[model samples]
Target: MNIKLIHSKVNAVLKAASPITLPVDIESIAKKRGLDVLPYELGPDVSGLLAIKDGKGTIGYNSTETRVRRRFTIAHELGHYELHKEKSDLFVDKQFIYRSQNSPITVDHQIMEHEANYFASCILMPTDQVRKELEKMDIDLVSEEGIKHLAKVFEVSTTAMSLRIDKLGFF
Candidate 1:
């Protein structure tokens, strides 16, 4: 699946939903797509999983993770559902790691993982909204405090928000 196409699709969904709050309601979005988001005691290495059986799709995230991490995991599984469901009925995502945008993609699994990560980032931190938030704050992106504040506002981990800023070319 093309990362750009998935990003575009997510953007369209966000626009249609018109979320008016800080942390986007990703669970509601999943429910809208006929996905049941559930919490499970997955081990540390496993982040989340998406399973589709008998025309029913379910997303399960690690219940032991922090709320922010769980939110991202749910969004990531939703990405798999959006982009890779036609290819497979089951997807088990492990050890959440995002490849840099410039990194090489040498395998099909790498492609799917990268695309899902990008989808999660885009859905959680839309470019225009993040830019608007930064403009409103007038803060330095390089500063840790600024990143933390933005992360809190978006209800995402500092690492995730920082990566989104870098991907947006905010430096």
Candidate 2:
């Protein structure tokens, strides 16, 4: 699917809900959209599972993962719930995602994975919200230190924040 369309969809959801805030309440957002979010002692390799049956949706995330990772997992599952529910009612992310020599995934599966990932990124770190936060911070926005600090502020991983910065073309 188109990246811009993905972004717009995320933005629309954010706008229609309560005002955008730091450390987005992902679980609440999912719940607001009629999804049940829960923490489970999922398999070591599995990050999350999105299952929708009989019009009811549940998001199960790995409880052992870091708070940051769990947040992303929830958002990723929510992506599948929002964007791919029509195609299939289930999605599993490991590593937290699938793509291995042992169990190879088809191209279509790869595409869905990619889209869900992008959706997660957009939901968890909306571009406008990130830019607004950057403006309020006095630190150097391009440094590793700044990235780490922002990651904490956004409640996302440092790597995720770094990628967001790079993707926004601030390097």
Predicted model with the maximum TM-score: 2
Q: What is the lDDT of residue 141 in candidate 2?
A: 85
How well does candidate 2 score on lDDT at residue 38? 91
lDDT of 1 by residue, 5-51 (tens): 98778977787678646788888888888899999998977889999
Judge candidate 1 at residue 71 and give its lDDT: 91
Query: How well does candidate 1 score on lDDT at residue 1?
Result: 56
Candidate 1 wrongly placed segments (more than 4 Å)? 96-106
Q: What CA root-mean-square deviation does each model show from the true structure?
A: 3.3, 1.7
Residue 52 accuracy (lDDT) in model 2: 97
**Relative to the unseen true structure, what is the Cα RMSD of model 1?**
3.3
Residue-pair clash count for candidate 2: 2
- For model 2, give the 10-residue run with minimal summed lDDT: 95-104
Model 2 residue runs over 4 Å out of place are 96-103
